[model samples]
Target chain A: MARDTRERLLDAGLALFAGNGLAGTTVSDLEARAGLRAGSGSFYRHFTSKEALFEAVVRQELDRFRTSIGDTTIGESTVADVKIALALEFHEALTTLGQLGQLEAIIHRDAHAMGDLFDEVEGLYNAALDASAARLNQLMESGQLPRRDPQALAVTIRSTLIGYHLNTQSFRRSARRVPPADLIAILIDLISSK
Target chain B: MARDTRERLLDAGLALFAGNGLAGTTVSDLEARAGLRAGSGSFYRHFTSKEALFEAVVRQELDRFRTSIGDTTIGESTVADVKIALALEFHEALTTLGQLGQLEAIIHRDAHAMGDLFDEVEGLYNAALDASAARLNQLMESGQLPRRDPQALAVTIRSTLIGYHLNTQSFRRSARRVPPADLIAILIDLISSK
Candidate 1:
């Protein structure tokens, strides 16, 4: 019950913060949004202040993001199986970032002011890219994949996934856009070193 | 002198709107930011209200964006030159978008509620994309580019550009990251059919 209340408070805080800048949202606003008593009474029981709540939300979202990328396992045994595994992994990771609309809102509000929180988020992003590159390098070394340029291919995959997610979600344009699988197919073709 | 003042008002609004939500920012705030006397007097001489000023800013920014992508001429000559030219054009368009930190803020606030203004902005983005695709199709038709999948490549370029611009600029993690020229070289290699 205690954990549920805490989660409820964090959810309210994220929605309020994302839509209204931190300065625009108030304690009482969060209280009401959380369906708790108005004013900071019940809110204070859970959080020290709105800023504290904001920090909690950041931590919670980061955990959620980490959970979303549960695994980055590249291959099991076969070469062809390795290729399929990578595409699936890439698609899943991209989906999480693409769907992280609310967290994205928080990041855009000059998140650098939040110090370590922003650092963690950005670090996670870079780690994702590095992991992808490492996986490609491993496959190349094993003679499974041949992009003739594994390093370059790794960056392109990461960039296209990021680009596709942000554009489709942000613009809300292109209702009939290219499916992710089709894009993965193209990436695989480009990965070949014919 | 009048046009200069108008431009000043638009500039002020763009910066303010991008950083602060439309509701958070006031006319007086814009006036002060523009170095004009506060309280909307000089502002009135330019825009009727803050909303009107926002519209003018959108128009000005769109014009600037279009200008950034001044020309997309392929070539009457060789495939390599044409490839280089297209890559250069794509890079410029992406640099503009990636560097649009301020404009991005306003977009996230769902400024579409402001109506035609947001439509115009979104439309400009779609048009830029359509133009790129058309340019690619033209090249493929003329046999200058022998890709088995020109359409896929066109979309990939646009998506990767959008993704790369958004990621690097947002994270600011990799100050010395993949240069656009390097990405372009990778792209040219991908365009090869053999």
Candidate 2:
């Protein structure tokens, strides 16, 4: 029961912080939402401070983020296959993190101030870039892709993916959908052209 | 003199807000940084509220954005002319906006709050698309370029440009700079191919 309570607190806190932002949420709100007594001081039992709790949540997510990249093997996939896997990974992360809004909020909140936090975020981005770069390099080595700077090409692909995420958030709320397969196909066509 | 004070306040506010974000700044910080008396209520004299002031500063920059597009006549130029103009515009906007980081911040902060804001941003994006489409349309009509879905082709081209901006921010921080002329040459080669 104690273990369950602690996990519940962490879960509740992540959801709130991701949605309402760091400064906008409080312990009482977490406690109530987690079904703990308002005066029980249970939050203290799990987290000494809100910042500490946030750090825990970030660490948990970062660990998962690292493992996620480790789990994917893009080198073996077709271009379309790689893109679909990546898009699915992003979608899963957003769903698991409670809200897509939370990912943005966390990036905005922690990217500058937290050293480990920023490192983790940059690490995730670079890992994806490296994966994409490797594939491009492979294609080039095999006389598939054109002879261009693989690093530059990889960076361009990654940047477009990030920008798509940044730009799509507004349209996302209206429940409109992007055909990721179509989008990826278009990207692959552009990249593979002569 | 009043106009000078307003300009000073706007400049200080832009630096502070761009560095720290909206919540991290205060009115006193604005006044002190602006070289006015601390807590002198001078900000209120120029602007009614902090949010209002921020909006005005953003608006001022956005007007400059509009002019930047106008000053570069890629939309009405020859194919070669348009390509050269676009390369310059991209280089300038990428360098300036990447350093400030405010344009993206403003879009992230406010793009989702209202449908109109979303539309406004889309307009900014689509204006580029429209410009590209018009040029392509002109080329097709003149038998200089092949006829195709100009709008879709424009979006693809704009998406690629967007991707370039996105990549420069992340991984191309140290690559050899591509001369605008060279970039124009590469793109012109691509378009002239089909």
The numbered model that scores best in DockQ is: 1
Two-chain DockQ for model 1: 0.47
Q: Give stretches of model 2 more than 4 Å off.
A: A1-45, A78-105, A170-179, B1-3, B37-41, B79-86, B92-101, B110-119, B137-149, B156-194
Q: After superposition, which runs of candidate 1 have C-alpha atoms over 4 Å from their true positions?
A: A1-3, A19-29, A37-42, A74-79, A147-152, A173-176, B1-3, B23-29, B37-48, B66-71, B74-80, B98-101, B148-151, B173-176
lDDT per model vs. reference: 0.70, 0.59
Per-residue CA lDDT of model 2 for B112-187, tens digit only, reads 3233445655566567557767867877897766555566555445444544554444333422343333433444
The stretch of ten residues in a row with the least summed lDDT in candidate 1 chain A is A70-79
Q: What TM-score would each prediction reach against the true structure?
A: 0.84, 0.75
- How would you encode candidate 2's per-residue C-alpha lDDT over A1-194 as one tens digit per residue? 45687788778877777555455467888888788887668789878988888877777767776776665654565655544544554444334333434554566533454556766576676766677677678777977766556666665554444445444553453112334443444455455556
Q: Write the per-residue lDDT of candidate 1 for residues A21-126, one digit (tens) a residue.
A: 6766788888887788786488888888788989888888888777665554433335466657677766776667665767877777647546788878877766
- lDDT (Cα) of model 1: 0.70
